[model samples]
Target chain A: MPEYTFLVVEDSPTMRQLISFALKRIPGSTIVEAGDGIDALKKLSNQKFDVILTDINMPLMDGLKLVSMVRNDPTYKDIPVIVITTEGADDARERGISLGANAYVSKPIQTQDLLNTVNEIIKSKA
Target chain B: MAKDSDSLSKKVENFLKVFKKGEEFTQELLQENEKLRYRLAQQEEVSKSSGRGEALNEQALEERLKTLEDENKSLLDRYHQVEEENKDFANRYIEVETENNNLANLYVASYQLHSTLDFNESLKIVLEIVMNLIGAEEFSIMMLDEKTNELSIVAQEGMGQDARKSIKMGSGIIGQVAKTGDAFYRDGDPTNLKGIDYTHPLVTIPLKIKEHVIGIIVIYKLLIQKTEFSNVDYELFSMLAGHAATALFSSKLYSQSERKLTTIQSFLDLLKEK
Candidate 1:
């Protein structure tokens, strides 16, 4: 299998770390971290990513807007986008998905579920 | 005739065997067709039911997601409100702390003002209080001599030699305050120092002994960090006005009494020797 690169966008450092830790389960996977949607966009423009995992609520630019921008952009539209959100964020999740988020994982995210979802999306794309 | 009967029976037997075989084959094919048709119907039903179930599930998920999003929004709003409240509390805490600190400073200033009986030491304490607590960098304490009607500098800080050493009573703002026995706060005006070589006077507190004005404390300039005097500084000035004069006056009387007592005691001893 080819090496996979993932972009993790979350405002909370701890949440970002947890997601990064779980992404490490995939062999030969590289992870990039961003503090918020704006930072994620900067990183997105600068590099290539196989998948983008983001939180719904973030400062300076939310995950929904990021998803819209990614989907609208020709270069990054096909990239698999995942949303991570709290349990009560149904509306935000819906917006995220409608804007072209491929999947959403609710908190507290089970490591296996996260891995399964990510792997399935990557496999389907592959 | 017997041979002819045998051949007809054989032909009839052959026809019966072929008819029976054809009927059995037709029955088997119909049963197989019916089983295949039933299986196909079941598969179609399963697929239709599953498609309906998936739609229902997606609808349920959408509803659930909506509810969760509302709850999340509510929680975030509450979190922001709590953060605002915390910030307000922190600001209030700082204000209260500063007020307490100012009160503490005033108490310390009053204590230092009356801690000594020596006139010079008392004057030094007053200067120290003004410089340290009142945040004045340039100032002086001047005593009024009733005999000459003149005010002379007793204690001074942060002034050039060209600064005024004496001011006759009834002359300038300083004289007006001394004559009227009223304290003056100039608010650190540069206009007041336009023609004067002396440093600017921000405030002048009159020191009173009973109803009489005994001296004046002139605050020439405030420290660089302090922009202006507050109400608390005025409160301190009022406290110094009464207590400072009493301390100085009583200490002068005490020394005079001690000297007179010593002379009388020595004279009595000489009489006892006689």
Candidate 2:
């Protein structure tokens, strides 16, 4: 089995930790945490990631901007992007998809939902 | 003349005898021909009847084959239906498993809160529970001071330094929750992060020991992604109200007892020196 690397970007340490913890449930998954989009970009430059999970609202660079940048970049364009949005943030969710995110998971996220979405994206890409 | 007449009569008698014998032979040949024709007709009728019987048997076999094909198709349709039903059951099982995992998370949070007896550790656990479980962005843990009848901020996250340090009991929403021991939730949209007045929080849960309220967990803003509270969030809030209160109270008592023990030990040491 191939090992999967995931980049989790969020401003809140608590949320970042929770997301990383949930991602760890996947077999052979390696998670890298970033405080915001800037940190995520820095990491992206250093190493290749299989999937990117980002939150919409961040301090330095928001998730939507990161998604657009990733889509524009030749190196990261093929990587699957999953945006984390608030439950009622329909506009943000649509914007994230339009910006080239592979999928979106709503906040107050259910662990199962996050897992299912990631698994689906990973299977499709495989 | 007498001799010639006798000879002629004898010759005529012989000729009539030969003619009668030839007629008998011809009648016997005709009878034999008629019997052979009747037997051939009977054989042809029997052969045609057997051919008809074979055709009837083939028609019955073809009908049987069609019925069997229809039955096979129905069985295949049922097989697909069962396959679909099995998929639905699997999905339901996953949902139940997810619920079970959520309950496990709650149990672990509760266990961690009570595992520590240090006052600061207990406070830290409460902060983590609120941040990780409730997804609060800006919030504070306030302990009620009985003497002053006011709630003071013991710990906070994402709140500005100039945030209010205390609230008088029964004064505002947070205070009212502390006074009544009932949890307070904002009426309007909880996701709107605009016009954030620190005085009015989105949720205020009163931490209590039995009937007495000890402190309150006031949340001003939730994380950007946390638009609304979930059922599990409510369960955590309820659990925190009671479990956090007990943990803090027990740790506070333990800290006081440790101080008293130190004072007594110091007194004993002085007496021994004298």
Candidate 3:
């Protein structure tokens, strides 16, 4: 798998670190942090990351808008966007998937399961 | 007949000359040798069996049986040791159960006191109860500050200023509950005095009345990693939070009612004077 930079866009600092903790458990990872969707875009403008791990609710710009923008961009269009959220209903999940998110993870995440899915998604892209 | 016997004995002697001297045991085992010839040679069958060769075999068999008996005895001793260990373990389990039951009774009594409306007094009582029940190395409650939009330590037990101040809303694991109104954990580093480590398997509960979040009730290091909060702990805390919420809300209404009662009494006196 190509070397990846996991950008965790979460407003809650605790959740940000939690997701970061789970991601860092993966071997040889480089993580980029963002407080919200706008912060994430600023980081994206500076450089490209392998996969984007975003939360649905954020200040400034929400995750749905971010996904739309990322998909529209010719340069970063192919990048897979995975939306991590607390909402588990079909409609909520369909909203994220329709917005071009490659995957969705429910809140109070299962650490090992997330890692396994992440590995598979990244490997498939290769 | 004597001549014939002498001739046969010379032939036998000549054959026996081929046998080695120390091969007596082999000669004794030979089918061709008869007791009658042995009697003529002044040896008896009874004496051969009862003498050196049989005695040596019997001695070796007894030694083998003696070692087997020793082995069996050692196994029997080990079995008794294991039985004693099992009994000790059972006794320990019973002791633990007794202690756990005692703590549970105490927990129920303490939680009953939480059914009072005065938030400050109620919280103080709750803190005292928690301190008395599960003693941690340190404990503190952080609530999200609406104005500051940060977390501040409101109540504390067994913690230093540095450890308490080391925490902030939206900064550490404790801050998650304050910010998101969701109960969560934060991993602590030994070097820094943070709220308990997230990995430490502590429990956090956000106090809510209806949909509004008031604060969180946290039990920290009630037990070490080896022991997680029991079902009793979870049930105990849940009941405590519920009672606390109802009391707090009722207290809020009671205070509000006092204000309105005074306002109405003053207005009635003004009307009487007019």
Question: Which has the greatest DockQ?
Answer: 2
Tens-digit lDDT string for candidate 3 (B13-117): 544443333244334433223433444234334447566655565555556556655655565565556556555655655455445444433444344454466
- Clashing residue pairs in candidate 1, if any? A88-B68, A88-B69, A89-B68, A89-B69, A90-B65, A90-B68, A90-B69
Q: What is the per-residue lDDT of model 2 for residues A12-106, given as tens digits with 9 covering 90 to 100?
A: 65467667767877878999999899999999999989999999999999999999999999988999999998766799999999999999998
Q: Please list the C-alpha lDDT of all candidates, in the order they appear.
A: 0.75, 0.82, 0.60
**TM-score for all models, in order of appearance:** 0.49, 0.58, 0.37
How many clashing residue pairs appear in each of the predictions shown? 7, 0, 6
True contacts kept of each: 0.00, 0.13, 0.00
Candidate 2 per-residue C-alpha lDDT over B58-79 given as tens digits, one digit per residue, 9 for 90 to 100:
5555565566556555655655
Better of 1 and 2 by lDDT: 2
Query: What's the alpha carbon RMSD for model 3?
Result: 26.4
For TM-score, candidate 2 versus 3, the one ahead is 2
Model 2 chain B poorest 10 in a row by lDDT: B1-10
lDDT per residue (tens digit) for residues B89-137 in model 1: 5565545544644455566566666666777677767775676557666
Task: Spell out the clash pairs found in candidate 3.
Answer: B151-B169, B186-B197, B186-B198, B187-B197, B187-B198, B188-B197
